[model samples]
Target: MRKIMTNKTSKYILLLICSMSLLSCEKFLDKQPNDMLNLDQVFSIRLETERYLANVYSYIPDPLVCNGVNYTPLSDEADWVFNWPHQQINTGNWSPVNTPYDIWSKYYKGIRAASTFINRVSECKECDELNPGITVQYREEARVLRAFYYFLLIRQYGPVTILPDVPLAIDAPLSEMQLPRNSYDECVDFIVSELDKAQQVLPDKQSNTREYGRTSAGMARALKARVLLYAASPLWNGNTDYADFKNKDGKQLVNQVYDQNKWRKAAEAAKSVIDKMPEGLYKKNGTDGKFDPFLSYQYVFLDRWNTEVIWARPMTGDAVRWERCSAPRQINGYIGLGPSQQLVDEYEMENGMSPFTAASTTANPVINPASGYTETGFSTTATKFTKAGIHNMYVGREPRFYATVGFNGMDWVYKGADGKTIIRVELFSTGKDGYNGSNDHSTTGYTTVKYVHPESDVRNGRHVLKSWIFFRLAEFYLNYAEALNEYDPQNPDIYKYINLIRERGGIPSLPEGLNQDQIRERIRHERRIELALEEHRFWDVKRWKIAEQTDAAPIYGMNVTTGTSFSDQNFYKRKITESRTFQKKHFLWPVPQYEIERNTELVQNPEW
Candidate 1:
């Protein structure tokens, strides 16, 4: 969603000095785009200042993009068909120096840009000359973006030095910049306060296509809700695992005492955003066809700037890189991403019930055979089912199941021949997306069809520019439901919000007679399904401190070897794709070794 504005009259640009000793002086960001200009020349005009903020926004990472890590692969949500940069971390092999993704350098670089903008934007009267009405709005954007970067920094690497208003001088002494990391509470307070201030200046929404993907009142509040949610999570609030964790100054990095008010604050912030979403959750009905939850969910991503999206990155032309990374190998795609069976099982039955009555082990997954979950054999066209000519295990499941995972024998209809036609996914050993050979195929027996546009012609390299959604209304409701239940265990509103999400997915609402724990369990289930591969599950598992249980287990897939022929194939048998490891120390990512080595004053995260 980042489009950097350019100016042909680019005489010079502001290159703020990297933070003294604490921050790596290594140039990150396009840190020195235009360096020869004086301060007055850089910030004196509207075009120059606009270009500065645009470059800062460029630093925001998209979820699906592969850096050192692919989001889905890092979590238990999926496995990669191709070798991923994050494999080391996924297999519990990363150290401080060797992380999946390094946020320390990236965000600090962004923070420097933002802090510089705030400190110098006011001095630029020429910018106000161009458009008086929008000058303050631009400044507020930089501020809110700065706070957002801090929020991002703290989430990945525990506590960080809070650079609120003061910008680092290009010539500042190294000693003056080697500040210690702020306490968890301090960083939270600063971010929440900044977002509150930003709301007053930013517009209520993106005004039009011209202002699309820019900072807005909704984005600020939505981010505030997210920051608070993490703050109140068990990993941050009352987390004794980091109780002994302190900086070199002896100040604690994480808050050990559990505070109920944190959850209350999170709930209030979430509700505030939820109240503003007049459209509420998106419903898929406008199209001329039967109301399908699958299409609705699919189009929420496909149709950018819909009722659900609060913040997104709109791209033009084709999404070539995205398609190459996630598409199926049979379609001349890289086939890098495969939804894991662990995630596949999370999709409940159509009745809104758990698929596994009790799956203590993946090998003998106790799926409810009563719900028409047949593993082997094929059905006929006259058989009352969506997958009439497909395997029973892939049919009659939740709408999201069909919308997300592409399984063997599943009818994958796309533009073909003379008109649109169905091509059954023949993943039976010698079949297209399953056979192991020269090409990379799905390791999990299923490739993610959720993000890929059904109309996208991977064969001809045809693809539409898709938006990377950062925030949406549905997440706020989920956030509100989670926080409310944590603060008031018996809160009835929790069930309403969670069920609202489920109803859109064509699943029945939660039945009555459930307690707080039951409600929370259902909410977690809904989040996994509703927000799968959206970059939330990975953070949720960590913040909930349940990674030891979730990430440490072996990943599962179908018994691909046994499925040699379509007529006689093995479907339900589970095969261990890969074993993962997660220790309690993994709750927080280590501050990079380079950062620690540069400044001895900086304290490393525990057990690194």
Candidate 2:
């Protein structure tokens, strides 16, 4: 007897047929087959362009949470930090067999999608009734997206073969596709030109609602500044980190240096964005804005068109549904992607100075319960740390520090516990489960609160709705300050921008007469702390060519044994703690052996 159909089964069968067709088509041709979409179908209206653009935002790779086997290694906490089980990385120890990061394919796929959209839209003249300007804007957006993909390539694998347009034939074989890598300079130029065109056609951030969340003139400019800054950094600029640089076309290129002009341009471009970008920061205005910045920051990853998010993938609906596969289980969220101690220590003390060396006169000292001493073994004169004896998890510290971390002694409320308005859990501890010891998540014994949803919030399934700040005002200001500081050093504008970021984060200003090196180091420290866990450290370490130093050896937190006593028990005292360390070779990731084996032109990264 034949069985009647059910809705779910029918849909599954349809999907299975499509998959089979795709597989069969692949076997029939040596080359991959293209989707059945046609130029007419794709560019029939602005809606099509909008939909295609949406694909770009939804393209973040998502892999299930199993044994911490995740996608996009940079985004993985283990890969980003030498914390927990991840400390095993970077030890001259990791061989090709245990290769950690292999991001070439995912990025290439992103590039391909952008290229397809650009090529398709440019060739179609289907905008007769549609605003001619709208078509141009769509094309510009596609170009910017394509440029973004290229920029990712240059940053990740150095030089990569850029296919700016789709192949004419759907079944074009790889043998026929002997495209060479483009020069870093040429690639940068191409991207900059595309961005220039985008700036001309793409609407300003405020005026574009229909094109909301789409790349804007400000975003294009901001990206251009970022690209220029990298080009001007030591890694790309005549530095040994890139001793054997090659372009996409396989041509050798000479090393360049941190050109003053490049820095000036970076500063100018960023300044342009800063001057025009809106000014909005969550202050201590009680209820309304109490958690708004947290919301704004989280929106970078959640909200599609958050004004604060200059550029981000709008991973929503199916994209997010698929993403759920990677989230920690409901029973207990996996601690796979935890933050590192390096990042935790990077946070400034309440006064905006390093806790390690802040001036003891002006800075507040939070006790290191383990040490039982106020100033010993801690940098009271540094930025962002309290004295040794105070509670590490005290409230009303620097706003950003509070915004960024959820420490052990602090009250951490999990959703729906005890039916309390807020279920309070201890973030800092003198025990294993306490905020800072061996079982602690962040290497520094600090857990990140940047992406976490507070217990009181009912929406978002108790999961965070904080948008990842792919690029934001704070970062832009910092970038501008870095470039200007490097270029002019004596400019008060550098101090101005740097101080603005500090003030917003609830930290003190830079002391008067600080040297360029001191200023630069502080700026770097700020970037590391402020941008922690946002997938910026990997690239920042590489570009600065300081991997030999920063990634050269395992980083560890200071060992401490805090005294703990059981209730009604005076018989014994116990100690609780946690620690991690990593090695250097883990700096440059292994070039995927599969790609190297297939393409003799490609060479594996050293010691990978």
Per-residue lDDT of model 1, residues 146-220, tens digit only: 988998888887788886478767698887777788888899999999999989877778655445667788899
Off by over 4 Å in 2: 1-53, 60-99, 122-133, 164-176, 206-211, 245-250, 254-258, 278-284, 287-307, 315-337, 358-396, 414-420, 426-444, 455-464, 555-587, 603-608
lDDT tens digits, residue span 402-442, model 2:
55554433444345544434322222334433324433233
Clashes of each: 1, 58
Score each candidate by Cα lDDT.
0.74, 0.51
Per-prediction TM-score: 0.91, 0.73
RMSD of each: 5.5, 9.6
Which candidate number maximizes TM-score?
1
Model 1 TM-score, all chains together: 0.91
Candidate 1: 10-residue stretch with minimal lDDT: 13-22
In model 1, which regions exceed 4 Å deviation?
1-33, 66-69, 286-290, 316-319, 381-385, 416-421
